[model samples]
Target: MPETVGDYLLQRLRDWGVEEVFSYPGDGINGILAAFEKAGNEPRFVQSRHEEMSAFQAVGFAKFTGRVGVCMATSGPGAVHLLNGLYDAKLDHVPVVAIVGQTARSAMGGHYQQEIDLQPLFKDVASEYLVEVNVAEQLPNALDRAFRTAEARRSPTAVIIPADLQEEEYTPPQHAFKHVPSSPPSVARSVVVPPDDEVGRAAEVLNSGEKVAVLVGQGARNAADEVRQLADITGAGVAKALLGKDVLPDDLPYVTGSIGLLGTRPSYELMRDCDTLLIVGSNFPYTQFMPEFGQARAVQIDIDGSLIGMRYPTEVNLVGEAKGTLRALLPLLQRKQDRSWRETIEKNVSDWWDTMEQQAMLEAKPVNPMRVVHELSPRIPEDAIVTADSGSSTNWYARNLRMRGRMRGSLSGTLATMGPAVPYAIGAKFAHPDRPVIALVGDGAMQMNGLAELITIARYRKLWSDPRLVVCVFHNNDLNQVTWELRAMGGSPKFEESQSIPDISYADIARSLGLEAIAVDTPDALGDAWDRVLAADRPAVLDVRCDPEVPPIPPHATFEQMKSTAESVLKGDPNAWHLMLQGAKTKVQEFIPNRR
Candidate 1:
């Protein structure tokens, strides 16, 4: 008999090879938290201020390590907050498991504090959901199901455990059985190829084009050789999405850059210049820039047939892995001999790349944080992990951070969420101390989740903390600049432009907590400050001011979107969704008041 559900979960986690899980103590999950503490710090439980922060920190862990980042939260709203970060993981194809505490099993049907319909809430966001009510019978099976599904699909999986059942006395099963691969081979599966003419026609589009390009995505993982073949065959350039970052190295010659708002000019402009696009395994959300006859003429190859033409139109949406598809289509492509078009596109690429270099070296103001990002990239230890928040900071790095040789970074992709980098840095440092951690957070993002809990870790670490956790902040005002852009739809933002906001002084906050703190207002000051901070043997924060008005991927004011805005303009009220976006529960009832 299992005495405590926490004990059962602990044993299960041990069996599944879970090394660490981030969490925050809450009323409903205290018993499980206690049980985890008894692990004698062998598998440490990292703590954060909010459940959302915990989940985001875990997201960072999964991104860098390629393991299932685990997080635990209390029942009700606590469990609900985990959904946002879980959505981030699921969409990014990152493996993660969120074990949320529920109310007492005995009080299952009755009303309970901090209770909500979490099962339904999590179902949509999570890849798989397993609920354990009868701990003795279901806990083992549920744990197995949750972990196996998460790894097989590389998405988020969840388990719900009632708080009371966690404390009930019962012994969980042993961890003696050998762990086998979750996915079993399917003999019923058979591979097929496109019709001969279909392949020939698709190849003809590439062969006939004066300027051809390969737009690779996640589908290019196993098809790297195929993509290389096409690029070599036609002298075509390649570009990748953020999720497809690993598909092509930034320094690769044929690789132009990423497309979209964060996309560099080289990729965006180069792709536009090409008459033909071979989209492989990318449902890139922004299709305005993509040649949309949509993807119809643009030959798209993907294993998942349903993803074809999902976001954009696909002219030749071939349903097969990119490697096999290209192999089948290879016999049809005549050895391309047109060197003039390829040479012209190459010149365009070189020009675009030169412009990007110029932008990197462009003169910046005293508070320009781009200078800091550029300088920091070179100074950080090799194999450094950078985690950045949403807001304007996302734009700063999107434009500046160069990742060719020395440094490496991982961000919360898919469901872009803020308030992640700080806690994420913590978890990242704990998980991999050899690789130094650098977290860039916006002022608004920090204010959302960067309070006492952050300092508490610093308090413990100041004396004995890992020397590699380095935190940098863009102390531009406590402002969500994206909101300002959204508000610009109807009214000119002149009044808000001159709105004076005092610098929040996060450095003072960190210093008060007994960690290294430096405020950098000018690039010169940042130079001196960074030198000292980088040399520190403990956690540190360089709170620097930055331009607040930058956001990557500027919004498109479509005629339809503008027409939608006219209703508000006609009504004389601007949208104030920033309050909700910032997760201000107190203002939820006030921001969008419902009239009786």
Candidate 2:
């Protein structure tokens, strides 16, 4: 039997060392489905309920493993469904290769069923690389370039294969005019180090400042040790961009927690007071949360030269890998003689954690959302991989959850999309089958798609060495984040019609899918619930009823924000009294001294 393009595609993916392809079956790619059976699923086809989930799982896998994630879908709607997740990958700077099916060539221009002009559709998302394979000869080069470009640019790339062409006999490109042949599959490695002159200038700026501050982003993951050394020499307080939350552990005395709207007081203070700033591997966009322009002399280190000085007005821009550039800079830096700045940062960090505890323990209608994460912080396994969905619950995950040991975590950092937490955990499981994965999701996100992905977790649990995948849902029965945004940002009362969501028992739903389940409505039960869920033999869901009125107040709330919230209350917000009371109780903790 002649090898079909579908068969060749799978063979090439295997040659590139792809272990799995997250996808769903569709007739547009009937050739690939047949090839999967003929090839004995060499590169496993891990199916998801939706193509979006498959793309998200690939993103999760890529993010955790530092490899290119691949996801496939059939033509039209199936291809359309992959956009959200692929956009998530693009925005967050993840490497992903999407193999999507297109309608048969003969039927493409006739207004055929499921025929949409795919080139324009994917032009933006896969802007790094997008090619349609018209002949078998184009398959290898097109696919290989997609992988190479995705890795080189750290962005999403795509290869479209027409349904009929996939079934045609495969043939290698001829050694003739107009033919392009690709080399064997392997990622080329290169080390980028900024010039010695640039590194020296950055060091000079660092040495001249009285209070130095370091901001680490996800790009700084590889340079954790270097970042620590830099911080130690300069006596700088390190603050993490949310995506870089795990870059440096919260346990570090000089490490302030997450920075931005969902940030901590210590992190806000670190930016506000520092005179010299060093940013590594993070392109955190919220410049307002950073040190005021011109107040601090800044230096940025990033592999991408384009993003180097875009965020802040940096005096020195180092275009190199964070680890290598920081390594060069460290040799030229002199240890700070003053210990006072270091002491102040440590004190601030300590007080912030105490305040987090106090706020987490405060009384609420049922469970304090902050306490849900606070309880899990100490109890979480040192090696656990945690994922959080976007919503009000993200505040707790960002501020309360402390990173320690070999733990890793992420969300849709740049996209800020919902429903990635559960799928991301699923991806994390595949990336490291031995590690336990936990997802902190809000009710709205769970309803959006996290609930459906539970079945995906249950199906794949046995494949993992450790079967403890816990989906902890904050069941507040509200679109809490947007509701608060309405009041805080828009000066408008929460319209119950838009803000309220269905109150469903997520635990019951999880049990129906043959997974362990637990429900906790009281603060006293949160710790025990987390313990049982973490210790479960299989995937589990912890559905805790959280307080909807608990405001995710910014660490540095401005007067305008306060005035807007007051206007919302006066305009008849449904939970005005509870919202104000909870806001007051939570904020008061920041000022209270920890007696313990």
Off by over 4 Å in 2: none
**Predicted candidate 2 versus true structure: per-residue lDDT over 3-46, tens digit per residue:** 99999999999999998899999988889989999999989899
Span of ten consecutive residues with least summed lDDT in model 1 = 179-188
Q: Pick the candidate with the highest TM-score.
A: 2
TM-score for candidate 2, residues paired by index: 0.99
Q: What is the C-alpha lDDT of each candidate?
A: 0.67, 0.94
The segments of candidate 1 whose C-alpha lies over 4 angstroms from its true place after superposition are 1-3, 169-209, 217-230, 294-296, 316-346, 357-365, 377-382, 451-453, 456-466, 478-480, 483-491, 494-502, 527-532, 549-596
lDDT of 1 by residue, 149-176 (tens): 7766668888887888778776444554
- In order of listing, the candidates' clash counts read 16, 0
Span of 10 residues, lowest total lDDT, candidate 2 = 587-596
Candidate number with greatest lDDT: 2
